[model samples]
Target: MRFPRTARLAPPAPAAAGDVLAEAERLHVRLGAREVLRGVDVTARAGEVLALVGPNGAGKSTLLAALAADLRAGAGVVRVHGRPAADWTAPELALRRAVLPQSTALSFPFTVEEVVRMGRAPWAGAAGTDDEAAVAGAMAATEVAEFAARPFSALSGGERARVAFARVLAQHAPLLLLDEPTAALDLRHQELVLRVCRERARAGDAVVVVLHDLGLAAAYAHRVAVLSAGRVAADGPPAEVFTGELLSDVYRQPVEVLAHPRTGAVLVAPRRDP
Candidate 1:
């Protein structure tokens, strides 16, 4: 799996819909003695939501971190915007991508608005940046504007998750790497978050998200990459990749993949009846 190496710091051409924003080619990553990813290949494309789905220990988060340049790939390469991820400086990477980790914990007491505004720091002193509008718009979109002044430390788990997501939206980067954005949300907020992901993709941003919920991945993701034992078991549209046999085998449980009676949306659930 040899890849042509692009020059460091080369100017990337203007990206459009269907363009690849980030990708992992023959990527392998190790954490201490444990190899988390092995020979994995995946891509995040503009105007699409690509979801990483698998059971625990499937290397989903490790792959996302590698693509974000937070983790070094031991064997292969991670490319972002036409160059190796290692070539980009932290500030440069911040301008091109925004990341949301699984945990949204703030040690200090900061207001919701203040926490959201922290996302704009990367754009400060840059010409033509409307900080206030970005902040307000993000808050409104995440439905957190009403509690803008409340302390982040005082918010509930779900509220904190939404506020953290508002911060990512405020960053306004072309690529978004989100790890379990819907894990802490209720039904309505979960739907809201996926809707926003779809909106971002429709607006020509590339979104890569790690989702534990198979139903959510089936319902909202434009494509699904099903991982198993540190490799991609299958990757394709939900209707194609999410068959019961594959999912059941990957998850190590008897599972059922069904379609909604009216809307024909894909549905996944563990098999309970003997």
Candidate 2:
């Protein structure tokens, strides 16, 4: 899980304050008879990682889709870069933001590098020769360079997941929307993915990720938004928002939030039944 120092891109210039990269206000969406998201209001800002955490069926994925502009909201508004998401052309939106869904189904037989190179399509006219560097750097960062020549369909779940992440990294968008980026990874790879998220935020990209792992969310996210029953239960800094009582109530389970003894980082765990 080691990455070469040279593979890391230099941090980009910091974004201006109060610059909202993506925002969803009073967003509502329904699928079939069930309302998936209910009046959810969330904003992702430059240079920050916002982790969306909630139990299953809490509408985390639905909200993420809305933010990515992949799903139309039944009500309210979703804006990216201060403009309505629907107004942006597909190519323009691809350059401004990238999305990694929970799962991808690619029936085409494409090499790993080819799949990663697809991310640069939006910039094909402007990127010139730089696309090679972007693709190589992305593969290196995700530790998928060794599989560049192999067919993407041949890779294992974790390997494919890493390659998929590399595709998003290669996109080089200002805003990133990731849904369950670490779900298919091993423990080490999970940490690696979250570390990549922090690095992206440091590079001035706004990142909003849906994470089921509360501990990972607490450790990496600058802000944590807890969703309960399709509503935002709490939103703030991890240390301030992720309390034992709040998490337990929102998740409808016995959960505990403790401070790490040495690092003072928040630790979340489910309580054992007595």
Candidate 3:
């Protein structure tokens, strides 16, 4: 679909470090009378996993929507595959990227397999066998195969989360946008979800996942982008971005960030003021 003249497109860019894959450059978005994103800049190199974090109403989801081009940013750029996000047609964009919004609601009693197969709809004339294979592979990866024949509406919240993730995997887009993929997952499934995200990055897909768990972001993100009040508070490797001062300032609470004993990854936890 063609956007109007008022739309903001990215300034011509030569990829920074010659490695940018997908990004938002000074992107801004407003909702009705309220501004949700205030000129956010983000970048993810090929095969990198970017963890997005912020308090509720901080615009983490809004930023994700802009990145996926589902929501237009008011006055900045969102680029995918080195081009303005608007440059791609719907079908082209679908083949190039996939987004899993936080709330995916379907009142109909669709089977889990049916839901996953919907991801393959982006492609034209994709064989049923091929679609089924993709569906099966995704279900297996998420360990949700047992529920494939079950109705999505009948599954528990976490079960539905996993099944939805399986759909994104089936999409096989080079870029992925996930909002709270582990919101209701058990510990084991949470780890599995992160592993699947990491494995996707390893295979050259760029991933941006919204996460509320600071510890998980520190442990899994190739980089973390912390948003506070609609702007990027810190963007860097976890150790640098999740610092005590940064966290305390952004979160408005006392906190501590220490290096993990084994992996040297940064660890964060709340600390009392006294």
| lDDT leader | 1
Displacement of residue 29 (Cα, Å) in model 1 is: 0.2
lDDT, candidate 1, 1-274, per-residue tens: 1113332332234579999999999999999999889999999999999999998999999999998999999999999887899999987888888999998887898899999998876776666668899999999999999999899999999999999999999998889999999999999999999999999999999999999999999999999999998999999999999999999899999999998999989999999995
Instruction: Assess the local accuracy of residue 110 in candidate 3 as a C-alpha lDDT between 0 and 100.
Output: 88
Q: All candidates' lDDT scores? A: 0.91, 0.89, 0.84
Q: What is the alpha-carbon lDDT for the whole of candidate 2?
A: 0.89
Deviation in angstroms for 225 in model 3?
0.6
Quick one: ranking by lDDT, best first?
1, 2, 3
Tell me the deviation in Å of residue 64 in model 3. 0.4
Compare the candidates by TM-score and give the number of the best one: 1
* Model 2 pairs in collision: none
**Candidate numbers sorted by TM-score from highest down:** 1, 2, 3
* Candidate 1 local Cα displacement, residue 231, angstroms: 0.5
- Stretches of candidate 2 above 4 Å error? 1-14, 127-129
